[model samples]
Target: MHTPLAVEHGANLKQYNTFGLPSNAQALVRITSESDVRRVVDDPALGLAPKFILGGGSNLVLTQDVRACVLKVEVMGRRVLETRDDAWIIEVGAGESWHETVQWTLDNGLPGLENMALIPGTVGAAPVQNIGAYGIELKDRFESLDAVDLITGRSVTLHSQHCAFGYRDSIFKRHLAGKGVITRVRLRLPRPWQPVLGYLELERKIAETGITAPDARQIFDWVCGIRSVKLPDPAVIGNAGSFFKNPVVTPEQCRDIINRDPEIVHYPMPDGTFKLAAGWMIDACGWKGKSIGRAGVYEKQALVLVNRGGASGAEVVTLAKAIQESVYGRFGIRLEPEPVVV
Candidate 1:
């Protein structure tokens, strides 16, 4: 039986990620079609332990040689299948770059995805984190997704409710995280657009420009512009954008932190918890631009940890642990990582 597969081991994974850290893979495979995905999974020649789904490779950290086969999804397609009076449901292949899908939505004049612009990674991985930026998340626009279960080789459509979305989390990440690979994702985008200026940065951007009712394309461009300017292009600095997720704490904890430091930036989580910006916490703790050996915190952003040069995965983990420990010690709040360290 003919099959598509990668013919290499100990391949340098540096270029595979935005982080540009040196790592190795035991095996690598790119599946261009839905059948190809199954074929690679069912390959007897390659003893299957488990497999890793490689998407945009932006929101992950390669800390060691992959002990599992890496299946790089190449399935790419996009279509506008349904239009409501105020919205359209767009079906996008899981392998499509999430940003590409966002761009497509804007190019077609869809409005919902404008706030989530410039987040790196594939459409499939978006659900993995229930990815968000500015003020919108994948869950906000999520209609459904189809994924192939590795164990049963069955396709299942998981609706947004089934995805179990939280702050940068989902069922695909929590329960069935490594169980299967997503093939398609459907999104319902707004047509009769409403501007979301809840995020401080976004609101500030629009306020500074004095633009009212900015269209989806302008909002997308503004987000891209802000991110490109504020965030160091990973191609140059070697980093996974935003290394830690914002900590959501109880309302009591929020008040306590506020009492301790009145200027602490905190947002109320939907579940009566207070969400604190991990970047602000880290920056306040003085970790920005701080380097531990070869691994250093990004100078521009406190939330991002960088591989200055010759840093190993273990080293990054160690530094992150230190930051976590330090943050907890200072504020009595635990910091959680945003990237998948695999």
Candidate 2:
């Protein structure tokens, strides 16, 4: 007979979350495989209990100790499902480190995920937020994903259309949140890989390096180099990558803000919407390098909120709210937090 899965009660969660906030799970179980999840589902004690699925803990804000049973995803695998003249289909376990997975793809001669290198999180969590960097987003390369419903313990495969991807938003964050556990993710990398150098920083890299034609590895290295200098390392600083999403606004609203603050940084989206830089707004409001309690805005990037050692999730939330209030008062655009606050 297979050994029973162990549930750890009063599990410390500080080490699990990127923010390093002190919290505890009432009960925690490590789900290393699909069978582990099924075991939890079939168990009489846990079957009907509320659940919280955790991956890399890179994009979360735990405000308090978790009351529901926490299922920590640790499944792992990666392989090329199919190789065609048009494209390559690759599949990876949900718990695989996203950065590592990107590197693995490059090592295996897959080139599509280079622009998204150094993104912190697990493959499973990537789709939940439609994680993006440079000029590429997860939705851009997504093909399909396998997830198991908590209520029924039945597996379902979802395509890109079913994901309902939006800017830092997804169906997983809406209809599927806490209801399903993603098991695997598939990526479709088209043949004749084209580097996404449209982002300003990447263009500057091209100018600085004088390499007009760069390959996938070049773009991956560039992205990693840029992120290393720009974003704080979570291990050292304790932060959720980008605290706030770039708020999208109408053209008229953009014009109104631009007229008021001529120096504001903004980008025009293909949809005719304007995406105002949240970092610039926070910096404009004088929040950069500032702190409230043990939480503070990162000195290097105002978009990041860091734990100034021993910070609680509540302090971070307080600091975020203050920034939001200031930005709204000045620009009339409410900043939405990117990380899911629990």
Candidate 3:
């Protein structure tokens, strides 16, 4: 016998992911119980076997055959930990789809996380990337989360401060990308949220009527509407969404590029740095919708590299390299891909 850890193969990964990118795993382990992790980790068939934790696969772009054993976190549970007329605390399993979790808050009439509506990925991966959009970040309402250390098989609690969130990055992303798997995350939300109103699109939305403040649900709906326009429906198109992070450069460096071409677009960061829109750069470099075989940059959002159909991981990587070369050659800034290429 191949043994339990070595026996089963799961669903076609092409459909499990929102990206719809064709990919597969040779051996799959769906982990429902935390204790099952220890058994899988120690399985003789998995002796020195490489391990990976998969959530919604919304943020990851699989680029090749995964020789490693893939663990699908199926842990599911959600509860209202503490609540009152004004304060609400909710805890959710990391396996919960993030978009669903956001919807749950709105349905319950609580007033946080609405601004983060429709972000694709699991709750566990949210903190890993410190997921943000519009004008709010997960860290803003974050309470804490439990993680099972793969090496020690011990569950540890991590507070918001311990997360060390900064611009689409956190502790799990930086140091424990593969070593720690999150079990659950708790978030504290207030009945009345402090409206986030700095994002340009958001500001323009509320600015239309010259409103002073917009409510959480209103802002949440707006964010969802905006993202829908910017990013393609993964069901209709196979894409990993944003292919690169908006490049952040010092003011001096930005000035050099702006001087070279006044048409260059950029946003000023709070840290006195300039966030150059990667999509704008790609489009400016004439790479938007540029196709090399079946892989290409999204026509609407240049930052997203899409698989038109019948595309392989190798083709995606090749297209990305070409885009990088073009952007770097024209602007002297190298575009970095956001997807975890496996």
Candidate 4:
């Protein structure tokens, strides 16, 4: 006989999200396996309730109490699934800590994931956000993923093509959002691993140390060091990293902004577009280190919004919207938030 599904009603959610915003889940369930997800889908009452799949909660801003059934993914495991002449395939459980998984790979001599070290959240949330840092995105090493359909309770596997990965986005954030729960992710680390050092920070690190040909471990350490100095620890001070995405604009638009503000930070994309630095723009607009209510913009980085001691989720949203308005008024460009506000 199957074990009874334990559900926590009116579960406190302040601890689940990185922002530490005050909120509660109407019903919460710890999902430890694919079967656990299927069980929730199969249950008459829970099956009928709207569902929300939660991972490490790093990429989220809970603006209100969740009325849906919250499935907290806690599944954990990691293994070298295959070692081929061309690549090494590593499969990781959805609930595995993303940063820990990166460290684990490096510890086991798998070098490709080092550039993405120190990223917050869970493995399952990685593909959903197509999380990237330094110069490597999750898609760069993606193989396939396993997920259970919320409606049908049937498990499915999807490859890169089906994922529709874009800049910090994937199918999970679009058509498949809230429709299924990712259970496991398989990463394909290409053989003869090469370091990705295209970011400006990495370049500076290379020049500073005169280590032009740094290895994967060095790149990893450099990324960790850079991020640690820039971002505030959520444990100490509640925050969701990078409140807004760097806005990508057409060449003409970029030039227009450049004409207005010569010192605007902008980078050329491979497709002839330009990605303007959102944080720089916010800082330019004088929003950095500013606060609205108890929510405040992080002094160290304008892209992050923090909860200043007992701040509510509504306050966080208010601050973000105010910053958005300020930026839009000045730049005529809307900054989209990186975090999922709900």
Per-residue CA lDDT of model 3 for 217-240, tens digit only, reads 788888898888888888788887
Q: What is the C-alpha local distance difference test score of each model?
A: 0.82, 0.94, 0.81, 0.94
TM-scores of the candidates are: 0.94, 0.99, 0.92, 0.99
Q: For each predicted model, how many residue pairs clash, with residues at least 3 apart or on different chains?
A: 0, 0, 0, 0
- Of the pair 1 and 4, which is ahead by lDDT? 4
Superposition error at 14 for model 3 (Å): 1.9
In model 4, the runs with Cα more than 4 Å from the true position are: none
Per-residue lDDT for 1-342 in model 2, tens only? 769889999999999999999999999999888888889999999998899999999999999999999999998999999998988999999999999999999999999999999999999999999999987899999999999989888889999999999999999999888999999999999997888889889999999999999999999999999998878999999999999999999999999999999999988899999999999999999999999999999999999999999999999999999999999999998999999899
Q: For residue 203, give model 2's deviation from the true position in Å.
A: 0.9
Candidates 1 and 2 compared: the better one by lDDT is 2
lDDT of 4 by residue, 158-264 (tens): 99999999999999999999999999999999998977888898999999999999988898899999999879999999998888999999999999999999999
Task: List residue ranges in candidate 1 displaced over 4 A.
Answer: 1-7
The alpha-carbon lDDT assigned to residue 287 of candidate 4 equals 89
Judging by lDDT, tell me the better candidate of 2 and 3: 2
TM-score, candidate number 2: 0.99
The digit string of per-residue lDDT tens for model 1 on 193-228 reads 787777787788778999976877888889998888
Q: Would you give me the overall lDDT of model 4?
A: 0.94
Instruction: Provide the lDDT at 132 for model 2.
Output: 95
